[model samples]
Target: MESVKLFGTWFSPYSRRVEMALKLKGVEYEYIEEDLKNKSPDLLKYNPVHKKVPLLIHNGKPISESLLILEYIDETWPGPAILPSDPYERSMARFWAKFLDEKCPPAMTRACMRTGEEQEKAYEEAIEVLTFLENELIGKKFFGGDTIGLVDITANLIAHWHRFFEEFSEIMQPPLITKEKFPNICEWVNDYTNCSFVQENLPEKDKLAQLYKARIQAAKAATQ
Candidate 1:
């Protein structure tokens, strides 16, 4: 049997996505939890440059970056397909995943954490970015059409984490995502989070909310 191990923190969306992919592939591996405050030696050694969690060690070779790790898992294992088979569709999947990772999180964070003008600017940018995503799901059940795929997996942040951030920030800021503004996305969130496999891998919402609440408080304190 091949040696497979994953180093990740429980509350990280990136880490959780990787775990979801591994479980989807039915790949049994060791999971090592990392404390972000104090670095782990093995994590540092394997991912010297980033020294980040969600690092995959397969047969002793390390793969960093959650998306790359997901692709690796799909290609290496025989199970449900993560990306599309067609070249164009696969490229589009990758495109949207990149867009989400690059565009959404920073804007969402600023929208929730910043105040006044900065928050307004971030909110507009986030809406624009999310509009693009909403249009992408026009007639589809998932980013992968009917089943979970690369884009769907990568969107765990938006579907899961963003909701909690909105709940915790409602007093300080308006919600970035809502049924009124993004119905398609709202439905997608319902579908994605309801999946039994996805649920099993998700961090508990209450715990995640507490973490985000602390982070939001910290960010506000820094700005003040």
Candidate 2:
């Protein structure tokens, strides 16, 4: 097998998604922590367009974007597939995953930076997107049904970094990740957190929270 190297930052939820997929697929790879401010020449050459973290290099070929890299990994390894086999179900999983990638993330990032009126608007948007997740979980244990699958991997943010948003964002006031507020999600957390791959790879919550807080502040400052 050719060498696989993951170029990522420590605190990016996007990078974590790829890492989780790689773990679930049982693929071994070198983990390279990148300095985003001063990206490695290899990273820039590999992903010149976005020039962002979470770039996966395989056999000297580079894959950019977390979701794309995930699909690539699954396609190549062909074990513990994150995506579903059934056509319709596969489409549904892709739909939800794309929704998270396109909508939920930007909404959360906006909520993190907004204050007063802007924050209120962002709060409404965030809740609206979160409602889809709640509704999607209605009859299914996981987004892909009984076992964790594609959309489940995409939605991994709720597992670890959710608290940082709830704690730091004054305007986006949904306590969705809390046990009392979301019993099923909370219940799911017990199994999700204990899963061997997830448990082993997850970063410490307190440390991650501090990093998340700092990133939010930095993003806010850069935009202002």
Candidate 3:
């Protein structure tokens, strides 16, 4: 077995996605936490292109980007398949992953970090994105079906981190994913978080709250 090392941070949703993929695949790896404010030499050397966390170093070779790393992990380890075998389904999974990656962060950032009209616009956009996901989640316990797979891994941000941000950030509006409004998403969140692997690797809520609080403060400071 080749040695695997993961460079990541505790509160990063991208890093957590990679961590969940590794844990679900039952891959044992050495986890090195990176300080985004002061990145380490190894992280810089390995992922010079993006210099981002969640870089997977396998047998001394580095893989960057969380989504690509998840795909690589699924391919490298056959123990538990994260992606569907069917070609069309696989494509759909990839499509949604890409959609969320491109659209989610900005909308969520707008909703949580900005205020007044900027926040209202972001809130609406964020709701649209979540609405699309809520529709996709209808009649499915997990985005990848019964078991948590590639789509679920990618969607983990919606299930966990997004909820946490809404909860902790005073700038964010009221909860958008309540059971009455988005039953499927709420159910999926419960199922995803209840999974033993997810429970074990999920970032502590209190720590994440503190981190996000500092971020909100920093963003406010930048404008004033």
Question: Quick one: best TM-score, which candidate?
Answer: 1
Candidate 3 lDDT (Cα, whole model)?
Answer: 0.87
Task: Name the lDDT value of residue 208 in candidate 1.
Answer: 89
- Relative to the true structure, candidate 1 has a C-alpha RMSD (angstroms) of 1.1
Model 3 RMSD in Å is 1.4
lDDT string for model 1 (16-112, tens) is: 9999999999999999999989989999999999999889999999999999999999999999999999999999999999999999999887787
Worst 10 residues of 3 by lDDT: 167-176
Best by lDDT: 1
Instruction: Write down the TM-score of every candidate.
Output: 0.97, 0.89, 0.95
By descending TM-score, how would the candidates be arranged?
Answer: 1, 3, 2
Stretches of candidate 2 off by over 4 Å are: 170-176, 179-181, 216-224
Residue runs of model 3 more than 4 Å from their true location after superposition: none
Where is model 1 more than 4 Å wrong at Cα?
170-173
Clashes of 1: 0
Candidate 3: tens digits of C-alpha lDDT, residues 119-148 = 898889988998999999888889988888
Which candidate, 2 or 3, would have the higher TM-score against the true structure? Answer: 3
